[model samples]
Target: MALFSFYNVRKPRQYNHTPIYWDPRKEALEERIRKNKRELGMEEPLEDYKPQIKGTFVEGTSHLKRSYNRGEDTRARKYKTFKFLLWLVVLGVIFWILFFK
Candidate 1:
């Protein structure tokens, strides 16, 4: 019976061989391209191939909605009208109390 001792913990053994990294998808794509070239009777290209960029206009969530009219904002105009009417009513009440009373 051991006292004041923790569970058995040992250092993992290190390996001598270097790890080989491989991508199956990339290999398959390259193989398919090579097969296509062979079928087309085209020579295998040593340089990188740059595909033509086709730009498509797609409306995304980040894109903002466009407004045609620059000067007229309906919400702001309504807010200003409401604010002016409220101030006019308040001033009229104050005037009636001071002079009429």
Candidate 2:
């Protein structure tokens, strides 16, 4: 038989509960709008004017796709060259520090 009960082991307590408070000024403004609508007895508001379009606007063409792909390839090549030059400079600095110092 066990000498002590395992239930006596203390459980971990939570430490991350942050309380949120409501703003009284926003609530008062919303209540005032509700009171105004009730006094005017308005079911729906007037619709705003919207501009109409005639034709569809095609954003991407075959030429645009080809140009975009070429730009991406040139960017990738430039990034690779920049990374290689950066590593070369770092290695040269390390070599100078080890040999000259």
Candidate 3:
């Protein structure tokens, strides 16, 4: 019986069939920017318009404080859950040793 094959004569096949994708949102955004550039100095940016930032990491008001309080609450809850599970495991071991041993 042969232990190993020391040579191969076959070559790998080449692939050049990559597909291109179209994005509707990006197209719309580009159109809007072009329109804005064409209408330059004709309109002023809206005073009430604000770029929205998502999640809890923000400045000002009771929102930031509330987020911090929520974080602390979750941390405390997780610690309490871990402690409860640890006790449950310890109790299971103690009961197994006392009755099954």
Please tell me which predicted candidate would have the highest lDDT against the true structure: 3
Q: Candidates' TM-scores?
A: 0.30, 0.30, 0.35
Model 1 lDDT per residue over 21-41, tens place: 888899999999898897686
Q: Which ranges in model 2 have alpha carbons more than 4 Å from their true place? A: 1-72
Per-model C-alpha lDDT, please? Answer: 0.65, 0.68, 0.71
Q: Summarize candidate 2's per-residue lDDT along 1-101 as a digit string, tens digits.
A: 77778888866997996659888899999988977876686633323222222111212456445645566555776797899999999999999999999
Residue pairs whose backbone atoms clash in candidate 1: none
lDDT of 3: 0.71
Give the clash count for each candidate.
Answer: 0, 0, 0
Report per-prediction Cα RMSD to one decimal: 17.4, 16.0, 11.0
Candidate 3 matches the true fold with a TM-score of 0.35
Inter-residue clash pairs, candidate 2: none
Instruction: Name model 1 segments beyond 4 Å from true.
Output: 1-72
